[model samples]
Target: MSTPLWIFDTTLRDGTQGEGISLTAEDKVKIALKLDAMGVHYIEGGNPGSNSKDIEFFRRVRELNLNAKLTAFGSTRRKNSVCEHDVNLKHLIESGARAATLVGKSWDFHVHTALQTTLEENLAMINESLAYVKNSGMEALFDAEHFFDGFKANPEYALAALSKAKEAGAAWIVLCDTNGGTLPGEIGEIVSRVVREIDAPIGIHTHNDCELAVANTLAAVAAGARQIQGTINGYGERCGNANLCSIIPTLQLKMGYGCVSDEQLKSLTGVARYVSEIANVHMPVNQPYVGNAAFAHKGGIHVSAIMKDSKTYEHIEPHLVGNKQRVLVSELAGQSNILSKAQEMGLDVNPENMKSREVIDRIKELEHQGYQFEGADASLELLLRDAYGGTAQAFIVDSFKIMVERTGGAMVTEAIVKLSVAGEQVYTVAEGNGPVNALDNALRKALVQYYPGIRDIHLSDYKVRVLDEKDTTAAKVRVLIESTNFKDTWSTVGVSSNVIEASWEALIDSIRYALLGMDKDEYVPEFVGGTHGLSNH
Candidate 1:
């Protein structure tokens, strides 16, 4: 039987300490419920004694019926203060939490400098806090703040702190890499020694200052720690806490620890994305296991190998974490890469077909001209459809014009677009706050009449990148636009020397893609496979 490794998520508490991250009382409860659904062992709600928001969060979270135990976090009692009288400890007890975790000074330096107390007083604080919580009928855990540094400074004092907490009935005595500078080797050794000296189960709480929080966490686990404390997506102060999104999979799949059930493990990617969405942080494309680029293949050789054998390049199956493998078509892609991409898109194409070769050649030529298709799946799909003679001409663009003027200290932009929808010409004009907005408004006005579903299509995000910095204003710019029709989101790309022209190309592709799905008799339009190529303009 595999050893059980408990997952303690501090996203609501430690995670919110990250820059630009703030969660409301409602957000905390919602995330706690999600973590519970994922079978997380513990959810550190927040420091109930710190602020009114956190106090309210603790009160509101009681409304939730979660599977995971909500742990209230606080610091130990002040020097020479009664544990029952301490406000922080009193708040923890009244927070209605089943578990309480207290952070106390373990480092002798912190005891002297930060706490301005003797080492023996720090130990007393740890013991009194844990004993008080246990006597109050709540599970108690003690976090030895700065444990690694404390051990290195004075091993005797640190061990005395853990021994005191253990004797006082701490269910788990956690070692914290508070400064986050310790390496994995050092952590493994120190944790092993601490576990040997203490009777209680050991837990690991790590930060990522040296970019080794996850590594050090696993190291501690290997050295006998069963509980791992981290935040979702590694959100925390400074470099951040250990990322449970990365650590959980590593523990279960790689290290053979039973952290969560198979069903719960699959929800890792969704939970990571959901937390990022709620926090208003951009989901990192390169985050391991849960990122968009985690299982994406862009290189020609890599794509070809992945087609033959996924294990050739990928370490683990993408679906294991609820992420899908993506084959990116780009300048580096070869003929095999194109064929594999086409097959993945459910398109019927032969590798030996001359049209396929022509498509590959065209892609190479276009990529040489600074038009990248890797990030523009919609545009690549349209190009492939045209090559396979499956092009659906929902609308034909006749012309478009954009004008900008400043009047009364305000800038106004207007766009006029003319298009032929099913051989009937439609002209529309619209005003907007910017040139792109005006063009988008005008284009939608022209198309929404012919295709009512087009009204559902909206631009979610737009990004522009310059290919050359030396040319400055004259440099070719690539515009990537993300569009959604309330059902699915797709990305399209356009490149040109003129920013407006680039935006226009992307906008047209976006509208056309939306119209294509509607023309398919309610079937969702996906990237279909075909000859991979770009047409010469």
Candidate 2:
């Protein structure tokens, strides 16, 4: 039988210590509920005494009645301070948490230099503080800060700290690699020794300074640690804490240790995304287990094999983690890449026919011309449809113009747009902070009356890349625009010698893609002009 293992999530506590991460009282409560639904064993919430905001979060979570034990975090009673009257301890008890985890100095160097206290006094603090919490009816967990480093330096003193915590009725002895500098081998050896000597259950906590937090945690588990302390998506101070996203799947699927149910495991991707969304952090596309590119196959050979047997290039089924395999078409693509990508986009193209052959040729030619379709799916869709002569000619852009001037020592920009829609000409003019803004405003103002969906479309991001530097100021540029209709976001790219023209191409594609998903009743006009701009061929 598999040994019983517990997952303790500390995302709300340590995760917030990450440089760009911050959560409100309501945010932490929401994350706690999500963890409970995901079947984690415990959630190490923030310290209510240090941050007043945490007090409100604990109060709010009480009404939630979460299944996972809510644990409060704090430092062991201040040096030479009484446990009963410790303000931090009082806040922890009043927070109404089910568990208390107090971190104490386990390294003799920290006891002398950092805390300015003797090793014996530090042991007394850990014992008394944990004893106070246990007596207050809260399960006490002692976090031995710097235990691995301390054990390496002075093995006897570190063992004495764990013994003190065990004697004080600590339900779990958590060995923490506080500095995040310990390697996996050291973690495994130290945890294995600690597990043999400590009477209480053992837990492992690590940081990612060396990018080995996950590896170190797994090593500890192999060494007989029953509890694993980590954060979702690896959010924490410095390089971050151990990533529960990678650890959970490895433990349950590969290591034969069950942490969550099979069904709950499928929600791993969703949970990582949800916390990322709430934290307003940009989820790395290459993050293991739950990233966009985790299972994506870009190489033609890889994609072809994945089509026959996904096991060829993938370690596990993508659906197991709620992510789907993506086939990307690029200059390095083959017939299989084109056909797979086209079919995925709902285009009526097949591998048996010569249609994918033509698409592949055109894609390579375009890539040679500084047009990349890998990251711009919206533009790629339009290009593919154009090849089949199925692209909808929604409207025609006859011409546009921009003017910039300085009046009263302030720069002003204006744009004029002329369009042909349904055999009728529509003209509009607008002013903006810049030429791109003016053009965007003018174009949208002209089309919003015909396509109400245009009103819903908003440009979220716009980036421009210089394709050549030898020409200096007269270099070809590529523009990538990310637009969203509040429901879905898509990206389009355009390349040209002029930045304005490149921006126009991407801006038009953004509008065209937005209208494609809108009401079909939108006016599709018969226009008199070229079907697309110079860059569209």
Q: Name the best candidate (by lDDT).
A: 1
Q: Could you list the CA RMSD of all candidates, in the order they appear?
A: 3.8, 4.2
Residue 206 alpha-carbon offset, candidate 2, angstroms:
1.1
Candidate 1 Cα RMSD after full superposition onto the native fold (Å): 3.8
Residue 95 CA error for candidate 1 (Å)?
A: 2.2
lDDT of 1 by residue, 268-304 (tens): 8888877876787766678999887888888888887
TM-score, candidate number 1: 0.88
Question: lDDT, candidate 2, residue 382?
Answer: 68
Model 2 Cα lDDT, one tens digit per residue, 306-328: 87888999888877876667776
Tell me the deviation in Å of residue 12 in model 1: 1.5
Q: Number of clashes in every candidate structure?
A: 0, 0
